[model samples]
Target: MRPLTAQDPDQLGRYRLLAQIGRGGMGQVLLGQGPDGRLVAVKQIHRQFTGNPEFQARFRREVLASQQVTGAYTAGVVDHDAESATPWLASEYIAGPALQDMIAEYGKLTVSGLKLLATGLAMALLEIHRTGLVHRDLKPSNVLLTNDGPRVIDFGIARALEDDLALTQTGTVLGSPAYMSPEQAECRPLTAASDVFAVGAILAMAATGASPFEAASTPQVLYNVLYTAADTSAVPPPLRPIVEACLAKDPAARPTPEQLLDLAGRIEAEPVWPVRIRRHIADCHAEAMAWADGTARSATPQAPAPPKKRWQRLVPIAAGVSVLTLVAIAITGIGQEGTAVAMDDPPLALTDDETRGLDVCALMKPDVLGELGTAVGELVPGGVTGCRVYYLDQSGQKIYFGLETSIPVGETRSGNQPMGTTINWMPVLGRYREALSCDRSVVTQSGLPLALTMTATPNAGNGCPAAERALAAVVRRLAVNPPLRADAPDSVLRMDACTLIDIAATSAVVGDPVRERTPHGCAATGRDGYFAVDIDDRVRPDNVVGGKVRPTTTIAGREVYVHHEAETYCEFIVMIRPTRDDRAEQVHTTYYSTLPDPPDTCDTAAGLLAPALAKLPTS
Candidate 1:
């Protein structure tokens, strides 16, 4: 209902934010990076539910249920702090976008895609049932199509068969009206069959762009779902029978997950299925690529492109190079310190003329692009140019890397702009280069590289000073270190143990040198304390700004304030004192992206902030 603004990184639990991926009635879903640097999705419950014990119980149940169903087809719950004042849950992040989005952007899946989706969904349902839980919400948005396969997510409203109704009162409706089974609609006892029926609804939607039951209002939709038959005519001829059987109002008549898998296998056996799916994924990838490219405004699906001539020799080369190059970039540049440091081994050589030809387009490739160009060309009307990869050689070593295409000049949105710096710190080729390198010591609390500058001008306009200030804030926050020993002058503080009070106190005594109006926030932590400060006054829409603001409070007797107004920028300053009181003192400072206001979802900022915070000494 509301946009997710950013928040203090320390406010969130272990999960670090990456981006605001999606939002729904339940809350905002943020893509986060975990301790292992693996991607995760964190769903924070709306603040309105923070005080509701019933909601908390339900959240706990959802976490439990999701944990029970961790398997191949399901997005597993990785970490959770349900008892926290503001509850949040994290799950392994599936790389691809949602099924609903894919369909809306590139049209419904072809026959083979339908089968893959159906098979995956059925297996997910089987896992959910095995755990004695029902994923009351089984919609297209909850199913994600990753490179590996389809992954089912969002068990926020899942209900266990044996558990008491902890969150919902007797009369409230729980599941999505469009996908709810008859039993779910009537609030009757539900079995795994309920999920089967819901999966059937999902399959129907996937095969055709519309739900089996269509109505303008919730009451109308519920009536259609419970009392009327689905219009199977829209479903492909080969898949109609299976969808119809699954949509049967009677739970007993619905096919089991195993049965659905069998049906999917049968459908896959159809001669047209493989071709249809290949084209569908290719199209979905294309549309996504187009969206990523800023070329397509609308997500409407276009007709599939004609088959291209197979380049037998090019296939293996493309696969190997793409995978190896991306892996190398992500692993090397994502969180490394210093400048572009050379690896012990020499860089892989690009032998093919085509690979060398890629250098013409230097900035279009992203570090981890996968089958995007091919997918986009097939699904969308116009063909997409190749994707580009960008990286900072923070290892202090120079390397040459080629781009697939030349960087577009000026401010046109034709190509996906590489964020941060354009001068490749890690060059595609040529002599050892340092001009393009970002100061590698700059890192978030969680150790991921922070975006030091804007890659492209956003619709909101380019705020270069703001971007530069944000970058400086990150540098300042990370540069501060604590004293090595208790007897050491307070000035020589350990960076990890330093707190806002320490910084402020130090500033008050030594004179604060850095006073830039940074567009981002500042984060620092040390063994004795931790602090997060926003340098800019950018209050997100969801934040409590203006009059409703509260005063600073003391955590462990250390003063903290979420300052909405400051000469340089609106900032939130939190300080915690050391508990040990008698050890060799040291301080650690870690900085990250600017913190957004609440409800705006500061997952990415938080992700960058947490590891640094964790590194801080906690006496």
Candidate 2:
């Protein structure tokens, strides 16, 4: 959990907000301490969203419905205050990482783990359905892997089975595209069966380490959901048939949540979680318990001081002194207007210190992060300060690129032995402390601050050879322009696209959000079509799709290239933050359609871009 920011309230209702665990379109999720010192997750809506009566009513209803769902499989609601200035709800805090994180770390769960996960989810659904609600959003990220068992969470999109809520206009969709059933994908009426299809998709993802319906864009995922069958080929033989049954296209053909529970009874595996996973869970639980004791968890730095000054501190000043102080404040605020901030520092690029041994991952430009934050996900610090790089390989399978600057606490180890012969010169670091292939840590006696690394997950590729190729590319990029440092900054343009774009404002231009996003980009789709805003560094220098890279306009002094093809697609390529000669580290865009025949694409795409870019604090 990240520490609460200065803007965060110290206490919400009876809970003390310790840290911000997550954030979404409507509100923030904080790890809070209840009055009795119990850990709870407090979800508070943003002040702006509270103006919508429909939104307020829907949230109030959902919170009320959630309280009725009490079970081991679900995170039960403990308290809520919808009538407050900012509607908020507090629920049981399960100490675990999201399923997406688990898959990213452990590849796929063991056969034993999968069954346990499915059983818990099925039971959770049965509970939710019994409460007369449908969990509209039930993707991998919605599931948490606690030490005891899996828990379904985030009923924010839930609705009473009978109340449609009119959340979306006629053609717009809801829920995650990759996990949506055929009916949900097509914006048809939903039933309990839609959720069953999603559970099957989740199982396939947990087994194969990716979504069966995942694609390059939102439309693709939706299209796959509507027309193609979920690819459960990689699922374990024992559970494959059960998963297939759940994924059946026809809602009526699929097994009910009760039937799923019966199927889960057949599979068996002791110690439900693998050793590595169990160890991680233990660490998570300990941290959570410690945090409940008032010592906030690791990722938390103390909350920053408020931007506003304390009134008491000004009381001692004279009338004239107070006036001067106000003037100073005004001037300081204006000064922040035209500054580029730290990220724009040209010299602060990633520069290698050969004497300290090569930082291999830094050698190549990594893949652009999508729906997830950063080109990498978790940036772990301390003993081994490093980050994890993720990318879809050529074959579309997700690949990992992990690098850690290791400072071993105890032993001053000697030469390392060969594991896969991929990094023969660089000694094997023993599989990256996690199971990974091509694990290389170049540590000589002189190189005490070791950079332990891994390029791909086990069994995902040519192992060491693939790592070598990725490393070589990094070197090539460095040869062109060396960087100064590796610390990522918080840039408005670099933030998640959903947060960047004003959904309330853009709803007129595009339809409701279908939650179309990548770690680095965001897209919203409706029946008419789709509009997307993406930020990519790859677009710099001649990385344009057709190699027809040419500047067409200057947007707020930054260059832009409008890639418009006849009637089907429109995208405004903008260089938001320039880094080097004619190249930018940040390229923001508004894209409409990958297909053809829509004339209003540019109007909608550019419509959102105009407002979004206007909000950028550019110098």
Candidate 3:
């Protein structure tokens, strides 16, 4: 929650504003305290729409419609004033993480969690339908995944059942495009069945990361919803019936909210949510208390809550009947906005690391390896070509995690057996050597193609599970942008030090380079004696400077730090990018030698870095 700006009013009517909850297309949501020590979510209409009679009418209708809504899985209206200069509505605050964020952070909910979400949402729809209201703007964002269960909020765009008042303009389609049912997408009359279709879509999304009509654009999504059947393969088996029925193009064929409750059965809410979500629920309460105690006065995150009359306070927080809890609160709109790359468009330029994206060493965390009685060992940096992570067990057994980045193919590479399962849509390959070791491969995303093979010597049963779990976590973390180096990067925080090194220049000094890879740089062999061109420039006096340190100029007019210009041992560093962390502050390539003869080592490294730097237009 952001601190109240000068433009913000301290009090809206009788409610005292605390912090900003959120602001949507319609208006701003402020976390406010009521006169009776009750915390409330106050939503004010945007200034642009303040004077419009049509807007006022809709706001009034919303107030009336919301007042009539009384359901367990809903944010009951506390108060409202549509006739005011700046219209506003207050509801019992329902604070919880949006469903989209929750699912994105933690994988899809367990079966129990999904079922709870489905059932609670169904019941909420039942209430809305009973009250002669059609929630035209039902999407993940509107659904608040609260501790008591999923409470369907946001009736700002809800259409009243009894009235023919048309607030929406003709041909201007409303509702979330991805979650829209066939009827809604076609701009046809909507009914409770349409909402049932949305519930199915929501459940499907909860089961799988993607939605039924998920596509690059809204037009494509709409076309798919109209023409193609939902790809329900990703959803778990048990929930297929609900998903299929709700997703049915024929609204009449769909099940009503009552039918869903029957399917949901007699489930009770007793903190059945996962441990992390449970913690969120506690945190939500803590934030609400914090808001009440004036803790949110500063710039700190706060949560939502509800306050009833003193008489209602006597009732337990979650009591009587089945306090159904399920469904996640997702905060997003109809369709994601972004231009889709056309087939004929020029090929998008890729970073060097993305070209050869596999960094097996990047995935290796010593702390995590320690859990399996293993510690991270040497790293075989393969630049963009691919790399390997070595590990040592407590018994000194060697373990290798070989990783290679490549293009997407129809099948897994030869020799690696499939794990018979996929996580986050990527195939997991597994190869076990009795009890000795387990080798695994991960088929990552398209651009960042990766094949991971992990094997542990003298492996026990723990290795397989550990490898699988760790692999899955790594894929999730690295699927988008994984750090491949310690320095800051174009996208991911890190890049391969090998990719940043100059092998050709090092080879020039010592005849032909042996090309031995290391974590940051490489160890190379020269012709006459021994020469090292370490491109991994960790700017330090002793590390970068060879004999005697002094500022010097390069052959190509680049500023550099020179050491031992004459003979014996010589070193030179060519600068690159400046960083605050100092680890990458000075991007320099250093060349060190113990030749005890001629040929300056600093000049050798400088020659290699010059060509690469010269090619960069920005550099």
The local distance difference test score of each candidate is: 0.46, 0.58, 0.57
TM-score of each: 0.45, 0.50, 0.48
Tens-digit lDDT track of model 3 for 1-619: 5566555679988999887765433356777889898888877765645776755765776778778887998878888777777778888876576665566557677777877788789889988999888876565656667766787876655676543233222433345556667766666556778788888887887788556776543356667876788988878777777788888999999989898777655434332467797687677777777777876566444365333322112110121111111111111122332222110011122234543333446556553243334546576644333455666655665566555443222234565665555544345576552344565565433333334445443434446655565565455334323444443445222333345445665566666766443323334566644443343323443243445555676545555566445454455554445433343323334455656565655456566556644432232
Alpha-carbon error at 200 in model 3, in Å? 0.6
User: What does candidate 1's lDDT look like per residue over 230-286, in tens digits?
Assistant: 998888987889899888899999899899988888874442333433455565455
Query: Clash number for every model?
Result: 84, 19, 16
Candidate 1, poorest ten consecutive residues by summed lDDT: 320-329
Which ranges in model 3 have alpha carbons more than 4 Å from their true place? Answer: 162-173, 266-271, 298-619
The parts of candidate 1 lying over 4 Å away from their true place are 1-11, 24-26, 164-169, 268-619
| Ranked candidates, highest lDDT first | 2, 3, 1
lDDT of 2: 0.58
Model 1 lDDT, residue 185, Cα: 65
What are the per-residue Cα lDDT tens digits for candidate 2 across 224-339?
Answer: 87778777879999789888998898999999999998888788665287778878877777776666665654445557633322211111111100000000000000111211
Judging by lDDT against the true structure, name the best candidate.
2
RMSD of each: 22.4, 21.7, 16.1
